[model samples]
Target: MSVDDFKHRGRRKMLVDLLRTKGIEDEKVLEAINLVPRHLFLDSAFIEYAYKDEAFPIAAGQTISHPFTVAFQTQLLDIHPNEKVLEIGTGSGYQTAVLVGLGAEVFTIERQKDLFDFSKIMLKKINFEPRYQTYGDGYKGLPSFAPFDKIIVTAGAPEIPNELLNQLKVGGIMVIPVGEESQQMLVIIKLSENQYEHYEFGNFKFVPMLERRDK
Candidate 1:
């Protein structure tokens, strides 16, 4: 049975409220979070706690990110309508759905075949169509579609990849986490061809960004 009903909406509203209390001030981000049925992105076993601000395991040993983490990173991006967004890790595609709801032209990538397939099915089912998605290396952000208005890496990178920086449009922003075990959420703004600005938010834990395609 479809769970995207009244109860789910209520939970989402409460989740948004919690995000607000936790310092997510962006109305657009909150609205997008409210509209997306986060429950639909989890396994049936985790459905009960899907609305809670916690990460839960999905397929391929990956976990869906906490709602707060999603909101925080999204707020940092300062997304504008019709902006082209390169999402490094599609995971459950929950973030991609939120990005599309925020009016971005999203291009997402996922390495795990199971997750790539799952996100494809779920996104199509919900009508959250990103402009493009592929199974590839996140380290080499979509060079063919370079100059993206924004780029978001959903996993924790040990070091910033220069390729992703190159893919970002001049003056564009990229929100990523850098570290091992735990990460510091970093918001990077490409100032010029070789210059960039960065700000580190607090720490967060995400599935480690793996190397190459997981075939």
Candidate 2:
């Protein structure tokens, strides 16, 4: 490995250590985070700060989520290998890549065309292939690929969309951040055919989930 590659490996290890300190206990989640190079998902100028436990600005005015947030949401999903997972916001595709690394069959949607296109190429270049990457409204989810075993929404929504809940399979789980301005509640919903259970995991801030595509 080159000097840079060695440095990044050390950075990733430190990041994993930080996450563990922050109460992220899932071994698989930590392994996936360690394997994927977060710096590669960042702009060259911000690459140096990629492993920090903080969000960073990406294209389309979206922020790649802080590492802890990503781990928190992914842990809530409790993903199993080969399970179909729908991600509501692709963002910088960093979270998507982490999902792919964990062996989930990922379907991610992005409202910003620039981010959608950019993330598509970035993920491909990194060899992390999401099953479907769509540029459309996240509130609509992806009905065509309904009944996903797991769903994760990276953006904060004012209200949880019924459409997304409908797409989740009975016995599946959906983790989302819901609120308007200020802090948002990180909610986990477990669905059954006729009933569902809700769990709140405190507050987190995220970019708003917009209704329309970026023009």
**Index of the highest-TM-score prediction:** 1
Q: lDDT of candidate 2?
A: 0.88
Worst 10 residues of 2 by lDDT: 182-191
lDDT of 1 by residue, 1-215 (tens): 35698888888889999999999999999999998988888998888788999999999999899999999999999988999999999998999999999999999999888999999999999999799999888898889988899999999999999999989889999999999999999999999999999999999998899975544
* Candidate 2 residue-wise lDDT, 7-75, digit = tens: 899999999999999999999999999989888888888888889999999998889999999998999
Off by over 4 Å in 2: 1-4, 212-215
TM per candidate: 0.97, 0.94
Please state every model's RMSD to the true fold in angstroms. Answer: 1.1, 2.1
Clash total of candidate 1:
0
